[model samples]
Target chain A: MTLLSALDYASVAVFALTGALVASRAQLDIVGFIFVACLTALGGGTLRDAILNRDMVFWVADPVMLAVAGSAAVTVFFSAHLLESRYRALLWLDACALAVAVPAGVGVAMGMGSAWPIVIVMGMITGCMGGLMRDVVCNEVPLVLKQGELYVTAAFAGAVAAVVAATFGLETGIALLICAAVTVTLRAGSLALGWRLPVYRARPPRNGPRN
Target chain B: MTLLSALDYASVAVFALTGALVASRAQLDIVGFIFVACLTALGGGTLRDAILNRDMVFWVADPVMLAVAGSAAVTVFFSAHLLESRYRALLWLDACALAVAVPAGVGVAMGMGSAWPIVIVMGMITGCMGGLMRDVVCNEVPLVLKQGELYVTAAFAGAVAAVVAATFGLETGIALLICAAVTVTLRAGSLALGWRLPVYRARPPRNGPRN
Candidate 1:
């Protein structure tokens, strides 16, 4: 398989695992588990292609990705009882998924001749949106918009590295490697170091008149 | 206000009301209510614009939508108890929001020079996706994916009508009005007549060997 295809496949697998872990924590049924796994695997690429106006969505054009994701989901569905872990491990797995997805997404966007800004944004979306959707579906706050670690920021940094490398005439292979490393390092580092962005307080509590 | 602006505002209000109703039913706290409300108001348009690769997603560009959506959310938060009687009425109001959003989304896509099929799909997405998001968030099955009365199909049909009208040299205003009527009529008819799509049953239950 081509290196890019390998990256894409790995990204899909990682994303599916992350999603399955999240669904397992929620004690979702088989259908729900499969639904989340597919969503996390395809959601970012779907959003990227749709935004780029690509001819067909990535998963719709390739059934194998769906098959792999489905198989992974099924495995998790039947084996969830054997994998009882805390939520923190799931968060780290989600971070790993982001690391895989961001660089792959940027590579795809760059391949499609997208502008750098769009590529960066698309990469971030591809890396982070599935988990965001997962959290929303699980009735939790989206991690991206929360006062958590630098999740999207890591994706953004990786995308920037990819874009810069491509612009500097680095070969696609080298660029992809650099970007993926950047994403993985930054995300893993943030997780290990407990890095966080400044919180935005939108609404201060209002003490209503002596209620 | 411009006609489009007025329609956008009205759509946001109606959509927020629908989300608030669902949030209340889900027994979510005030923050959850606001979150769902914001998603309902801007989620469809955001998806449409993102898919079309339009620069400056509507809510990201114009903060007024957020303001209106937030205000509606807070209002609903305070008045949720007073809205107990209007839950059923809000269902039709949700249908009305779809009637407005589908045509508006189509108009935006056509104006942006997308293909007819893409525009129609965007319209369907704009009309149906927010409610789908809300349902998924509340852990309920999405209405569009279920064997419920026609929802997305009605939006698609209305969008097609609008596109056809514009192709035939009709005024934009008249075309949008026709599309709105089509969507509302189709949805209301389905609701009243108990129309539904064929259920996607995988298979009938079969007797199995005892383990």
Candidate 2:
């Protein structure tokens, strides 16, 4: 199998694990776990393909991806109770998934010869949107949208790195490697070293009831 | 200028109003209002077009739909406080939008010569997904999934009505009209007359911590 496909599978598995962990936290049934896992694993890529108007969505083209996600969900459904800290596991697994997914998105856009902006946006979307959707659907504040997190910033920087590397005529595989490395490094830094961004601190409305 | 286009515009506008009202309740700024409005208005159609592999997303092709959503957001930004019960307004407006949107989805699927099941699913997705996204994003239990509510059932029944009408040699326009009428009547009955479907009542797990 191609390295790219391997990375895609890895990301799907990890993201599905995180999603099923979340479903466990929500106390969902096995069917709910599978549904959430598949949704979280496939949501970002699906949206990217849709926006790019790909001939077929990735999972639709290869049902094995769906199987991978479902397997992850089933595994987590039985094993999640043993985890002492599912949230921490979710965060770290999500970072790893994001690292791989950003490169996947960049590669697809680059393959399609999309403009730099579109390439960058697609990478961020692919890396971030699945988690965002999972959080939103599960009624949690999205990690990507959390104040002071470097999650989106990391994805953006990684995508930009890929674009810049490609602009300089770097090999496609090397550029994607650089993208993944940068993404994971920054995400890891945020998780382990407390890296942060400035957060919006809204002032009280001058003349309205507070929401 | 066609009746279909008119209905599409009406749905977008009303859905945008509901989204903006949600934003108001969420205490978001003007930009947030516009973002939520556009997302809520265009999200379902975007997913529909993507799944159907349309040449372009509806708002991307028309652009005017985005403008309509944005305008609704701006208007609601200044005026939402005037409503005594924003939630009530949201429910009614959402029902109206669902009525229009289901027919739009059915029309698109029928135009593509999709099978009956696809037609029913596409109609339900287009009518129900936007509101589901909105509520999920805002951290509310999704109205579509609310216990005993007829929201999804109404969309499903409406789509089936359209398919059955068309199969019986009805004109396309008349079939969609029937779709809209059925959707609105069922949704309105649920709202006004407390019509309902049986809800899942989960028994306590034989052995697990209460979620």
Best by lDDT: 2
B1-211 per-residue lDDT for model 1 (tens digits): 8656676777888898888767666555454555678778877888888767786667645667766876887776666555434456557878898998888787788778888899889889889988887777666677666566779878988998988998999987778888889999888888788776776655655776433
Which ten-residue region of model 2 chain B has the weakest summed lDDT? B26-35
Which residue pairs collide, candidate 2? none
* Interface RMSD for candidate 2 relative to the native interface: 5.9
Error of 2 at A119 (Å): 7.8
Question: Residue A107 of candidate 2: its Cα lDDT?
Answer: 88
**lDDT by residue (tens digit), candidate 1, A1-211:** 8777787788888788778878887888878888999988888888777766677888878889998888888887777667556467677777778877887788787887766766776777688778877787677766554444566667878888988998899998788788888988877887788765443222322432211
Instruction: For model 2, report the TM-score of its A chain.
Output: 0.94
Question: In candidate 2, which residue ranges exceed 4 Å CA deviation?
Answer: A1-43, A55-124, A134-139, A144-211, B29-35, B60-64, B197-211
DockQ of each: 0.08, 0.11
